[model samples]
Target: MTRAQHPAGDPGEVARAFEEMPAVLWAFAGPQHRVVAANRAARASVGDREGIVGRPIREVVPEMAGQQIFEMIDEVYATGHPVSHADRRVLVDRDGDGHLEEDFYTYTFLPTRGPDGAVTGMVVHIVETTRWVRQRQAVEARADDSERRYREARDVVLGLQRSLLPAGVPLLPRLRIAARYVVAGADAAAGGDWFDSVVLPDDRVALLVGDVVGHGAEAAGVMGQLRAVALQALVSGAGVLDSLRRLDTLAGCLPAAVGATVCLVVVDPRTGDLEYASRAHPAPLLLGPGGSARFLDGAPTGPLGADGKPARRHHDRLGPGELVVLYSDGLIERPGQALSAGQAELARVATAVLSEPVAPGSTLPALTADRLGALLVERFAWAGYRDDVTVLVAERQPEPPEPPALRLPAIPASLAAVRVAMRAWLGALGVPALPAQAVQHTLGEAAANAVEHAYRAGDPGEFTVAAGLDERGVLRLTVTDRGRWRPAPDDPQDRGRGLMLMRALADRVEVAAGELGTAVTIEHRLQRPAQVSAGAAPPEPAAEAREVPFRIEAGADGPRVLRVSGPVDLATAGELERAVRAAGRGGLLPVTLDLAGVTLLSSGGVRLLHRLDAGADPAGLRLRAPRGGAVHQVLALTGLEHLVT
Candidate 1:
C-alpha cells in the first residue's frame, strides 16, 4: 500500500513536488539566458509570478542586471559547468516598491545538458540566509560594547589605585625604609592594593600594607579611605591594636571593604623593638643579620568586617642590620598553590636577596632597604600576578660609636671644658645644631653648679662628666662630684637658680645627693630629622658666627620693638642678651622683643629671656611672638608662654 500510494515515479506528481519545495528554483535556456520555467518560490522572490516565466533572466528581475547572475547562468549553459555561492548578498526590490533592500543567499547554477552532452540550459537553486546573518551581527555588536566598558572601568580603577599610594617612604635616621607597588596582569582588572611608611612623633617608623577584596573604582576608593584612617591613627601615636581597631570600624561602614586585610608594624629603630598587628593579613617576614628569616605570626585576627574577634599587638625585636618585610597577600598568593607554600617561598626569596653580599666599594654598608624591596617584588612577580602586589622593607641601622667620657677638675675653668666636650660629642651623634647647643648649655650649668657648691672653699676636687645615648635614643648626661653635698640656704635667690635652669633646659633632670657627693642626671630624647641619613658626618661648624639681624622700630609711640630674625641658640644668645640690655638702657626704657621671625628658640634663648625678665620690670620688657609659631610653641612647652604678648 505504501509503495503504490507514494506516486514516487509519476512525472506530473514529481514536477508538482519540485515546484512546491521551499527552496527557490528556476531554469534559463539559450545564450541569452532566457528564463523558461520557475517554481512558486522563485517567482515570488522576484515579486512576480505569471510574468517571470518565459522571459530573459535580466528582464524577469531587472535588479539582477549588474549583479552578474545572468552571466553565471550563461556560463553554466555554454560550458556545461556549475557555479555556487554561499551567503551571497543580493539587492532586489522584492516588494516592487522601487527601493532595493539587502538579502543574503546560498545559491547554485547547474548546467542542464541535452542527449548529445552539449549544455542546453542552466537550472538555479537558492536558499535565503538573511535572518541568520543579521542575528550573528547583532550578537557581535553587543560583545564589542561590553568589552569596551570593561576596559574603561579597569583604567579608571588603576588610576585611582596609583594616586592613593604613598609617593615615597619616609627616610629615618635609625630605620631605612622603602616600598613598592605592582599592578595585576594586563588582561585582569586592577585590584586594590596599597603601602605606606610614616615616621611617628616618637621617631618610630610605622610600615603598612593592605588589600581590598574586589576590583575597580569601589575597591580603590575603599582602599584609599582605609589607608587614610590607619595613617591618621598611627601619626596620632595610636598603638598597633588601636590603629587596626579604627581601620576595622571604618571598614565595617564600607561594604566594599568587607574582606579587606592589613598588616601594620611600628618599630623603634634605636632599640630594634617592633610591635605589629594584623587583620587577616599575612605575617611579616623578619630577616636577621645572620642570614635567617621567619614570619611574625604571633598576633592574628579575622579580616575586616568579619565576625567579632579582638585584635592583638605582637612584640618582636629586630637586631641591627636586620630587616622586617611587610607585603600584601598578592605577593604570597598564586593559582593552584597553597597559601602556606606561597608564604614560604616569599621568606626564602627575601632571605636570599637580603643576604647577598654587598658589591665591592658600594656606598652602603650592606643591602639597602630600597634595593631589598625591589628585589623581593621582582622575584615574586616576574611571571606576572593576578592581583596587585606590594612590598615594604624596614631595616635597622647599626649602632653609632660612643663618645669618650670627660673628667675635669672642679674649678671655674672646668665649666668651659665641659661645654667643649659636650658640643663635640653631640655633633658626632648627628644632633641638630639647636638641640646640640641646648644640651651643651644645660651640661655647662650642671658643671658650674658642681664647681661652686660640690666642695668646701679651697678644697681641691675633681668632677666627672659622662654622656651616653641609650637604646631608645635618649642622651643621658651624669655630672658626678666627690665632695660633700651642701644644702641650699633658706634664701631663694642664689642657691636654687642653677637647679631650676637644669630642669627647664633638659627633658628630665634628677639630683642625687648623699655622703658620696652629688650626681645630676639629665635625659633628653635626641630627635633626628628624616632628611639626615644614618652615620652621616656632622656638617662643618660655621667658622664665623652668624650675625643676628636686629633692627629697632618705634611702634607708633608705644615702645622700641627689637625684631630678631635668626636662630637664638647658645652661640648667638649672648649677643642677643647684650643687645636687649643696651636697648633697656639700665632698665630706664621700655623694650619689646618681637620673636616672630626667630627660626629657633633654644633653651639658651629661653634662659636669656629669664635673666632679662628678672632684671627689668615686667612691664619694661615685653615679648611678641606669633601664636602657633616655633617660638610660641617652645615658650609654651617651657612654661614661659605668659611672657609672650
Candidate 2:
C-alpha cells in the first residue's frame, strides 16, 4: 500500500485510469471545437480516438453538424458560462456501424478558463439516458391503455343496464302511469335500479320500484333476474307481500352477499284500493287534488335476501284523480340530504304538480304519466346523483261506467243493432278475429229469433241483448224477450231454423221459456291461437251415442259411414271430427262419410269435412250418394264431392 507501489503513483497509470471513465469526456482546444483529448467512453461512442483527436466534433459525427448541440456549445464558448442539459439528443456511431444512431444523454459543456480568467478551450461530459427515458415512456403508455379499458368496461355495463329496463309503462285500464330512469355518474357504471307496471292474474295492476345491491354489469344482471322473479310471482297470483317474500327467497338462492330493496303496489282497478309491500324501501308519495300529499310508508320489511323474513302488507284507498309516486332511493338520496328529507322534498314536488290545473284540452294518460315522471326527476335528481334514480308515478283514473245493454223493440231493425253492438264490444275486448265472428253470428241469430218469433204485430214486445268477456277469457251473450211464445210448425220445412242456427254457433246454448219472458244464454270460450292445446282431441259421444246427432261406421268391404241426423254446423263440427277420427283410427280403407241424415249443413261442417278429405290417406275416403237433400245441395254448391270420391 506504499505510494510508490500504488498505480496512481505513476503518471502513465493515472492517465490510463482517467482515459477509462464510464462517462463520455472530451476537450476541444480551438474555436472550431477541435477534439484535443478524449476518454475511452468518447472514443467508443465516436470510434477510435487515433484519427478523431484534433478533429472538430462536427467532423467526427457528421450528423450533429447542423443541429442545436453545436449552437449550444458555441454559446458556452463565447460567453464563458457553462451550460447543462438533462436529456440532450445526440447522434453517434456507438455500434461502430459507420452510420450514427440517435440517443438521449445528460450533457454539460464548460469553458476551461486560463490564468487571466479568459476562456481557452471547452470541456464536455455526458451520460447516456436513452434506456431510462424509453422505459418511462413505456410505463406511461401502459397506464393510458389501462384507463381506456376501464372506461370501455363501464360503458358496456351501462348498456346492459339500459337493455334490461322496461321499454315503457303498461296501459292498465284504470291507471295513468309515467316513469323515468337516470344513471349515477358519467364515469361510474350503471347501478341496479328498475321500475315496472305489470298486470297480475287478478287483473289488478302491480307497480314495482326496486334497487339491487351494487353497481356495474353484475348488479344489472342480478336486477333483471330479481325483477323477473317478482313479476312471475305476481302473475302467478301472489299477493303483494307474498310476491316480495318470493323475491326474497329467490335472492337467497342467488350468489351470497347479493341483496335488493323493493316496493310492490297492487291496485284493484275496480275499487281503487291499493295493497302495498316494502322491503326496506322508501315509502310512496300520495298526491291528491289541491296540493294534498302524504307518504304510504307504514309497512316495512327487511331488505330482500336478509334472512328471508316475511314482509307486511299495507292498504290505502286511492281515489280517482289522485297520484301515487313510487321510486328507488336514488331518486331522493343526494349528498347532504337524509332519506326522510328526500322523501319530504319529493312530496313537495308532487303536490306542486298536482296543484297545477289540467290544461283545457284533454291530456292523454301516457302523456300525463311522462310529464309527472319528468317533473319529479327534474326536481330531485337533476345533477350529481350518486346512485341510479328511477321514479314511477301512477294516477288512478275514474272508474269507467258499465257498458250499456241494447234494449231494442221486437223489430227487424233491432237485429242489426244487436250485431253492431256485439261487434263493437268484442273489438274493445281485444277478441281475436275468429272468436269475434262466431260471437257476432250467434248473438245476431238470438236477437233475430226474438224479433221474428217471440212477438206478433200487435204485441210489439221488446228484446234486450248484452255481451261481455269474463276474466276467464270466456265470451258471454244474453238475449231476452218479453213476449208470448209461438208454437212451432208441425212440418220440418215450415218450422223456422232460428234456434238451430244459434245452437250451431255457440259452445253452449241455454233457452228458458215462461209467461214472463224468454231468455237465451250463449257462451263461447275465447282462446288465443297459441294457447289452444294440440292434444285437445275430440271427445267420444256419451253412452246415449245413438241419440247423438252424428254417427260413424267403419268397414273394409265398403266406404265408412258418418251419418248426420241434426243440423251440421259450428256446434256439431266437433262431433263429426271425433266420429271421423274414431273411424280412421280403426284402419278401415276407403272410408265413407255419409251425410244422408243431415237436416241442415253450415259452413263450419263443410270446412271440417273438406279438411278431413283433403288430408286423408290416398284413396282413403268416399261419400255415400246424396239425393238432393241439404247435405247434397251444400256439397254441390261448394264442389266438395271430388275429395270424397
Q: Name the candidate that leads on lDDT.
A: 1
Worst 10 residues of 2 by lDDT: 531-540
The lDDT values for all models are 0.70, 0.66
Instruction: Give lDDT tens digits, candidate 2, residues 410-434.
Output: 8765554555565555544434444
Error (Å) of candidate 2 at residue 108 is 55
Positional deviation of residue 617's Cα in model 2 after best superposition, in angstroms: 48
Q: Can you give the lDDT of residue 9 in candidate 2?
A: 72
Which residue runs of candidate 1 sit more than 4 Å off their true CA positions?
1-258, 264-393, 409-445, 455-462, 472-474, 484-491, 494-508, 525-579, 592-611, 614-618, 624-640
TM-score per prediction, in order, is: 0.41, 0.40
| Candidate 2: regions farther than 4 A off | 1-159, 185-187, 358-367, 401-645
